[model samples]
Target: MSTIELKNLVISKISEVNDEAFLLAINTILDSKSESILILSDDQKSSIKKSQKEYLEGNYFSNDSVNEEMEKWLKQ
Candidate 1:
């Protein structure tokens, strides 16, 4: 298969994953191989970089924050 086709298949399989650690490993491997692989689009590359930075900086929201938002929506 072509490189882009292989990347698409890998991305599709990655999306089917639900385990956080496994996803991180997959992303890390992809990043390491990036120089030798097809470049990700600007948006996709930005999103991955942003998410990794957020994760590294402990910038994620809590489940309670989501629950509170949901409750507020229900009350409206």
Candidate 2:
């Protein structure tokens, strides 16, 4: 069926219902559609920007190098 038809069908079905808990659950599901944005702190923002700069400057370790270091540490 089309989107409008489906929505209308749901509305008709919901109107015939009288269960408080079920209606609350439906309301919660609808409310979750628009999620809130994350608010980052100054320190976190600075750290992310610093990491991005480091990445752009090619100062980061390779995955193979990190794995080798982890293996050495684990063996010790």
Candidate 3:
């Protein structure tokens, strides 16, 4: 389901819940989500842009291939 649908489902479920403690826990989680702001430095931003360019050029390794190589190296 989409984010909206998932959110509506959660809201519906929470409405059905009558436990005060459980509602408090959910409120705490929502509060923490609002506080999660991230600030990236210029160097980090440049690195991310470079990585995105490389990805768009199809220059990245496949997850399965990387795992296979890691397993082989670990066995050495």
Candidate 4:
């Protein structure tokens, strides 16, 4: 079906829905869909940039090293 037709069909179906729990579930789905944008804080942006720079400079630890440290910490 076309987009407009599908939307109309959905609206018609929604209008026919009378169950409280089902209506709440549909409302929750619509609410989640409406909040699609992600807004990051300035601190989060700065941290992401710093991490990217460190990764490009090869200043991060290796997976093996991190695993070894974790194993040692677990033993302690």
Sliding window of 10 residues with minimal summed lDDT for model 4 = 30-39
Error of 3 at 34 (Å): 4.2
Q: Which pairs clash inside model 1?
A: none
TM-score of 1: 0.40
lDDT of each: 0.91, 0.95, 0.97, 0.97
Model 2 has an lDDT value of 0.95
- Summed backbone clashes in each candidate are 0, 0, 0, 0
After aligning candidate 3 to the native by TM-score, how far in Å is the CA of 33 from where it should be? 4.2
Q: Which stretches of candidate 1 lie over 4 Å from their true place?
A: 34-76
- For model 2, the superposed segments whose C-alpha errors exceed 4 Å read 1-17
Cα distance off (Å), candidate 2, residue 67: 0.7
Error at 53, model 3, angstroms: 0.3
Q: Which residues of candidate 4, in runs, are more than 4 Å off?
A: 1-12, 33-37, 72-76
**RMSD values, in order shown:** 16.6, 3.0, 5.8, 3.3
TM-score of each: 0.40, 0.60, 0.52, 0.61
> What tens-digit string does per-residue lDDT give for candidate 4 at 27-68?
999999988878899999999999999999999999999999
User: Which pairs clash (backbone N, Cα, C closer than 3 Å) in model 4?
Assistant: none
Per-residue accuracy of model 3 over 13-47 as CA lDDT, tens digit each: 99999999999999999999987987899999999
